[model samples]
Target: MKCTEVNRLLNPYIDGELDLQNVLAVEAHLQECPRCNAAIAGIQTMRTAISRACEPAKAPLRLREAVQAQFAGTAAPRQATSLSLGVCLAAAPGIAALLIVGWLALAQPWNAQSNAGTAQGTRIVYHLAGGNHVKANLRTLKNHLDAEPNLQVVVVAHSDGINFLLQGAKDTEGQPYIGALRELRARGVEFRVCTNTLTRQQIDTRAVVPEAVLVPSGIAEISRLQKREGYTYLRL
Candidate 1:
């Protein structure tokens, strides 16, 4: 099998979705290809980082009480209802997961200083996941810096957020966004583009604007910044 064929099959192979024949072909190709092997390692590292970052957080007492109340409120009258304490307890985990997802979707900007033991200084990780808000987000960043000159900012881009970081990418005025990116870089803001997105989208590394640095995984990088570097998380 050729490198291109193996590259196409890498994800399926990792997921154990490839049939035996194709699996063997990909493995054989990987054995002789350093590049493919490194790709697999990078993916596995990202998976591990994500897994660590996603470990189930204990539901807050209020949320748990609300969930329990919700379950109780919807139950039929005692004589007709089959709901029990054991059933509610058993269902708590799944309900908590859904509630957590919803909470994340509705979450506002979080300041690291509010948490004990977080590092000092105003360190922020501004996360971007869509192309539509690039200009607005950058404007917000500029305003933030103007308000707090000593603040440290890192812009982490993934998915369609990487669009503005591509070479020749333009803003509403038909001017390239790279000029704004360069200005931001000059102001000590770091722009990180995800290499995983690049590979999945088949974008050449050189196609990214020189002002942005490529990281293994934008999500993983965000996780690291929040958990390990004490950076506040702001998704915009």
Candidate 2:
């Protein structure tokens, strides 16, 4: 990884948001790049300082009761009555302090934890089984890859879904899918086809797209990625 890429990923790395692949890349770069290492150290120091500065003090009982009542769908106590100018001036300091404390208490670090994989970047297994929406599915995959450069994505296509992976296949709108598929492949997306489905449909393996890897079973691949590799599954 270059210094520019490492700089872009530094915040996520600090917040534990990077996947295993990216984490390794960033760590490797940091070891060789003294400037990048110092930058990360400064970031860590800033984070620690802010966390300590924003440490929350206990909230008043009234505020706790009001918050609890809101969550429980119960009526809360009425707001305080209007105060005279002199009374308002007297209470302003305390109100400001309360607001500051409350805000600090609610403040949190930007720690993006992936539910799919613990201590790793996000890994997703997208299931494509409908012919009518093949274009949409591929489009969504491209959008996801564009949005999350660090994401690990795999598309498992079987049955009708495998139609899109066939050589010379066009989408519902009669537009070819190869161009988009190629671009996504360049972005680290993996396309998998079910050999079982091809056999059932009497489709030739030679006719499948060169980009797709043949898996024994689509469902089995999905299950294996989810159970063994901690990939999140989504069907479309």
Candidate 3:
């Protein structure tokens, strides 16, 4: 990996946010480059200094209660080790955005209460296996939904197409698609991402926007939706 790339990813690496491939690449590069190794050490030292300098504070009771309430409906509530209410307060904006996105994704297909109504409709499964024409495809889907209110649309993304639904992902102009996704979602469109692709590509499921649910296999999902559910298939 280039020095520039290594430098850019150092923080994410330290934060335990890098995917498997990146972790390996960064470790390999750190072994060969003394400069980067020194940089990593310096960053660690700085973090340690800040941690020691700051006074420890207890988490607010209200915040803890709110978090508990939010995950109360989940089949298996997610837990974070070493994550405190203070860390959540420190990154509230970013954390709130991710939480909202996660709520949107998890609420759709996973929540039986919500799915009870959404699951029954004229279904159409859209296959997305490539990144090309993402915007155009989304636009088309939106237009189709506008024409048919009772139609249920599900977008299954895999391979290169998965990047479109990744968190903070942008188009050529550096514009986020979450707004558009939210709009479509409000109109009853669903988005599902493939776990197989994520595993093969060494990507963390959290890296994807919360607007998309994670499916076991994109191709298998498409097939099931078409056959068992009588969903019409469209590839883009």
All models: lDDT?
Answer: 0.70, 0.69, 0.71
Model 2 TM-score on a 0 to 1 scale: 0.51
User: After aligning candidate 2 to the native by TM-score, how far in Å is the CA of 10 from where it should be?
Assistant: 78
Error of 1 at 222 (Å): 0.4
* Tens-digit lDDT track of model 1 for 97-212: 43333223222223222442233446767777777645766776787778767668899999988999998999877888987888889989999999999999999999998889
lDDT of 1: 0.70
Better of 2 and 3 by lDDT: 3
- Tens digits of per-residue lDDT for model 3, 42-62: 999999999999979987764
- Model 3's lDDT to the true fold? 0.71
lDDT per residue for candidate 2 within 44-125, as digits (tens), equals 9999999989987897664554344222211222332121122222334434443332222212111232244434546767
CA RMSD of each candidate after superposition = 18.5, 27.9, 19.9
Which 10-residue window of candidate 1 scores lowest in summed lDDT?
75-84
Model 3 residue 122 CA deviation in Å: 2.6
Runs off by more than 4 Å, candidate 1: 1-120
